[model samples]
Target: MIHPLNFDSLLFGYPVGKINVDQSWDEQGFLEEAKTFQLVYIFSQSELKYSSETVRLVDIKATFFKRLDQSADGCSSLERPNGELDQRLVKLAFESGAYSRFKVDERLDNEEFEKLYRLWIQKAWENREILSLPEKEGMVTVSIDGDSGKIGLLAVHPDSRGKGWGKKLVKAAEMQAKREGAQGLYIPTQLDNLPACHLYQSTGYTLSQKEYIYHYWRN
Candidate 1:
C-alpha cells in the first residue's frame, strides 16, 4: 500500500502501490537543496516572477511519456548523487574564475553537493529537461571581461516550466558573482526565447551588448 504522502515519490517513478519511505534527514536535506536552487532560479531574472501556478511538481512520466528508467539524463558528475548538473556547471564557472581571481580553494561538501544534486532531480521530477553538453564532451567557460564571466549550455528541464526558475537562477548567479567581487555575469541566448528575455530583464540583467557569432569551418 502506498502512503498518500509518498505520492511525491511517484513524481520520480516509484511504483504506484509501494510506500516510499525516507529518513527525516534525507527529506530535510532535499528540501533545503531544492530551496537553494529554487532561490537561485527565481532570482536570476529581472522579469521572471515566482508564481505557484507556474512552479509546481508535475508528473515526470506523463511528460516524458515513458518509464523513468528510460529517459537519457545528462549532468555534471562533479558531485555525488550527481544530477543537479546546472549547479555544478555554475559552481565550475565560479571555481575557474574565482580561483584565478581570488586564489581561494573551496569545494562543496558531500552533503551540500548531494543536496544540490537532489535539487536537479526535483526539477526533473517536476518535468523540466536539463540541456547540458553531451557526456564527456568537455564544456567550456569564458571570461567576459575583467569583472565578468560566462557559461554556455545552461537550461531548465522541459517539464518544469512557468515557475520562473530561469530568472531566479540568473539572479542567483549575479548575486554569487557580486559576492565574489565580480562586477557582473554575461550570457548569450537566441533572441526568440522571449521568456528568457523577460526573465533576464526582471532579474536586473540587461541586454548590454550583442554580436554575430559566426561559425565558419572547412570540412
Candidate 2:
C-alpha cells in the first residue's frame, strides 16, 4: 500500500492517519493494509458510481474547455481593480469566489484561507492575470499558464452573481488566453454549481468530461 499526500485536504475524518489511493489498486490487498493502520481512507476521483458498504461516491466534478475564435484585447495581472472596500471583506470575497463549493475549502481555517489568498495572488502576479470589477459586486482571479494558455481559478462574488459579472470575467480570461497564444482554456467545476457551469457554457465552453470524487473507509 502507498501513502499519498492529500494536497486538496480530502481526508474526511483522520487527516493524519487516513491515506488516499487510486481506485484501480487491488482492493483486498489495500484493505488488508488498512488493518495495520489505526484507520484508513481510500479516496479517488472517477465517474459516478453506486455507493457500497466500503466504497462511496462523494462528489461530482465537471470539466469544460474553450477554443478562442478571434484575438481579444487582453489585460495583465497588474490591472486588478481596487474596490476600496474593507480589506477583510475583499479578502473574504476573493477567497470564496471560486472555491466555496469544494468540500476541502470548507475545511479551510483562517490560516489556510490566508495562505490560499496569498498563493492565488502570487500565482496571478507571477504567471496569470486577474479580472476584477473593483466594486462590491465583482471580484475574480483567473490564473493562466502562459505556455499552454490554460486559464484557471475563475471566481466571482456571490453578491456579484446573476448580473453577468462572471460571464464578463470569463470573456476577459478567454481574450487573455488567446493573446498568450494558448490553444484554449480549460476549467473544472462542481456539478452542483449550476450558475458557474451555466456561465461557462454560455461563454462558449464545451463540456469536456464528467468526474466524481469518492471516499472509501472503515473504522
Best by TM-score: 2
- Candidate 1 minimal-lDDT segment of 10 residues: 58-67
Model 1 steric clash total: 29
Model 2 alpha-carbon drift over 4 Å, by segment? 1-3, 6-25, 33-56, 71-78, 81-122, 125-128, 216-219
Per-model lDDT = 0.33, 0.55
Error of 2 at 160 (Å): 2.7
**Candidate 2 per-residue lDDT over residues 89-197, each given as its tens digit:** 3463454544333234333333444554555555554442655555534445555466345445565565556776666767767776676677677877777778778
Deviation (Å) of 113 in candidate 1? 28
Error of 1 at 22 (Å): 61
- Which RMSD values do the candidates have, in order? 21.0, 5.3
Clashes of 2: 0
> Which candidate has the top score in lDDT?
2
